[model samples]
Target: MQLEPGAVVEGRITRVTDFGAFIQFDNGETGLVHISQIAHSFVRNIHDHVREGESIEVKVLGRDERGRLDLSIKELLEEPEEVPRPRAIGRQSPQFEAKLRSFMRDAKERTTSGAPVKKSTSTKRKK
Candidate 1:
């Protein structure tokens, strides 16, 4: 079967890695499901979610320029239709502060690097 980019498919988990899982399509095409694409939440380990030789449904998010099929299990699974339980919204934590500081540091470095950054160039037509 010709595996088109963005096609949804079901594949067998041939191997699992700390970084991602390798899947084999029914037609014998194999691809890697990047760790980041494995789940919506942070994935501490790939094996925790999928076992080797297990068949899992996935969406072919796309292929890289080299024709590597990028798979996503979370994208193929239907999200819970039930309303989410309400939690304390906007509650700040120490982790949030740490992440904010890290982002600011990176932003500062990028600004000082003298690298050209893309910006909106479209002129808004005035009425």
Candidate 2:
């Protein structure tokens, strides 16, 4: 089989490492699916996504300088829907707006008065 870039193929997971997983094709060709290409989301552990002897579909992401195949599992998977960011605090929360306004006012007062703002630190007592 011609393992060209952009080709999709099914293979068996021969080994899983900290950085990536090794896939062995039916033709005895082996490829490395880097941890970054394992999932669309952040992958903290490669073992959690793939294990030895497991069968998975991977996309051929071309070969490296050493002529080894670089594959990706996330490329075959659909992209996750993006979540909209929360609205600004002042627009949504009145309490936060009030606190922000109070803080701004205090900051202005301190600046105008030429006084340095003092931060309170609690002292721990030893028994």
Q: What Cα-based lDDT does every candidate model obtain?
A: 0.83, 0.91
- The TM-score between candidate 2 and the true structure equals 0.64
Residue 20 displacement in candidate 1 (angstroms) = 0.3
User: Please, what are the lDDT tens digits per residue for candidate 1 over residues 8-127?
Assistant: 778899988889999999787899999988766667777789999898888888889998888888886566666345365786899999999999999998899999877988798879
Q: What is the TM-score of each candidate against the true structure?
A: 0.59, 0.64
Question: Candidate 1, residue 62: CA error in Å?
Answer: 1.3
Which stretches in model 2 have alpha-carbon errors above 4 Å?
83-127
The superposed Cα distance between candidate 1 and the true structure at residue 23, in angstroms, equals 0.4
lDDT of 2 by residue, 9-115 (tens): 99999999999999999999999999989887778888888989999989999999999999999999888897335466555488888999999998899989977
Best by TM-score: 2
- Those runs of model 1 whose alpha carbons end farther than 4 Å from true positions after fitting are 78-127
